[model samples]
Target: MAFLVVSRYSPLFAILFVASLAGLHCESPGKSPAFSFRFERFEKNRSLDAVIALYGDAEISDFVVGITRPAVFSSGRVVYRKPVRFLGRNPSFSTYFAFSVSSPDGGEGLAFFLAPSSSPVKESTNGLHFGLPPGATAVKFETRTEPETGSHIRVEVGGEISKQSSNLSNVSLVLHGGEKVHSWVDYDGDSKRFEVRLSKSSDSRPLSPLVSYPIDLSRVLQREEKLVGISSSSGNSTQTSSVYSWSFAVKRGAPYSMHSEPLDPRPFVVRARESPPIHLRRTYPWGVFVAMVFAAACGGLLTFFVMFVWFALIARRPVAPVEYPVHPVEVGYQQIELVAGEKGVDSTKK
Candidate 1:
């Protein structure tokens, strides 16, 4: 690792040297760019474990030492469902997602990384460095308002930037939370070349690779087990972004088509969402149902009140006794006895 760096930046200088040692080919950044499938193409189960932060909260919601806000020392990560397939010969893997960032002065920026899985996602002391985990390879996307520096891309391998190989130039595109920009990272197993592309639209890939490096994965990856995901950070500078969608895959058959595009980009068509980050759809119905129940309860109370008032009014009046007429065809026995007593012993004689 120490001997790989012998000089200053030159076109494909570091890449050539590195690839030679590893026995791989890295394409130049100026070459024709193409490749990668959209994330929407995958099913829901593709996710292994996700540790990204949403709404200023982290994927691990119950933790005390996790990131909870933007523009702070924060980073987010999403581990693939399984170790990316590698034959230990030549391997190809890709991750694509659209991100939007907003910062006033300068933000530390976002990073794409691969690291070992621990009990919990590691948090860096500073956001500018993306709380870089040990043995991690990361590519950072800095915003124009980074507190310490201007906007640019910085690549870190093994927790340190290879000054001789890293690019420290400003990108022309303006990034914010409103408008999303598409980014693609593709590692060609055939060439052992890694390339990245960024664009404003998913209908098209970037015209050319933003940065290209020749890395032989079979050498760097010790075991077949590893993690692939993204992270971002900000110190004093405030920033915002979202991982709206993402996808990853391992090849077993043929080399992927160098030129393949989706028939329908569907920029206007909103696909049936599998789920939303924060769901209010169900809450809407619950609210309506609760209100209806409350209304019915009030109506019942009103009816009871009206009936009570009617009873009070009725109580103020006196109720008259009802009389029944009776026929005296058969004289009351008491009356007959009274007559007999009046007439003396007449009843006894009868």
Candidate 2:
């Protein structure tokens, strides 16, 4: 009787043990999170429905998000209306945006950033740290050129500016040119690779990134809901910064697509934004020189042909001899030539 009772209950105990193990497996901390949102442009009346809140001087008008006014000490932030769960043991994300910074004199610049949802915005002209909150992780687009760093893009953590992650002194792109500039920022949680790509609205995403720094998001960001947004500020110099479109997505188990479809109508096509390589730049002068030399030779040949044709077919014709017409009186004079000659001879003799 004791052996029978033990056998019957052993099956139930084994089942319970298996179910507990399954529960533990499902809630593993290594699992990645999922969050995605895209903004091609803001609608006129539906700005509030876009799930974004404007703070300070930030405003949305006619499908554009204006982050800051063109006035000194002006600063603003356009952040998500609600906090998002952006943290996992290893969190990865990809984001793309089209922005423009325009003014007579370029302003400080702007940033696409992530911060603790509870952190408050701090307004300051403290260089690249403007409009950022504590414990914020940002990729800043710096337009103002300094003697030491010039124009650059850098990653800032905890509202503190660090050495530029990527230098833009020699790049052809003008951040404050008042034209739409597109940028892509992607991170691989598994590889700890953080990349930043910059281009024009008409250009495609570059093959190579401007900045690819090794960063562990788990260390930089807190394991809580994050507020994702863009921030900008103007110092003594004033500039207008606008966001034409923006898209962001947290990576899942599958590889994230960089060119995912946007929520709104696509703005414009994109070509490659890479600068010409050193070899190509070096060959450009030779190519132009060759073209000019060929053109000059063609012109010289044409001139020579025109001159030859003139001398051969038009300028060397035979000249006609001079002629005098004989009249009736001239004929009579000719008939008396011999008599006249004899008289002249006799006179000379006498």
- Once fitted onto the true fold, the runs of candidate 1 whose alpha carbons sit more than 4 angstroms away are 1-56, 59-68, 118-128, 144-150, 162-171, 176-178, 222-224, 252-270, 274-350
Worst 10 residues of 2 by lDDT: 274-283
Kindly list the per-residue Cα lDDT of model 2 for residues 169-188, writing each as its tens digit: 57678787788888888888
**Model 2, runs deviating above 4 Å:** 1-33, 46-50, 122-128, 252-350
Instruction: Report the error of model 2 at residue 291, Å.
Output: 63
Question: Clashing residue pairs, candidate 2?
Answer: 203-271, 204-270, 204-271
TM-score of each: 0.53, 0.63
Q: Name the lDDT of candidate 2.
A: 0.67
For model 2, state the Cα shift of residue 196 in Å: 0.8
RMSD of each: 27.7, 33.2
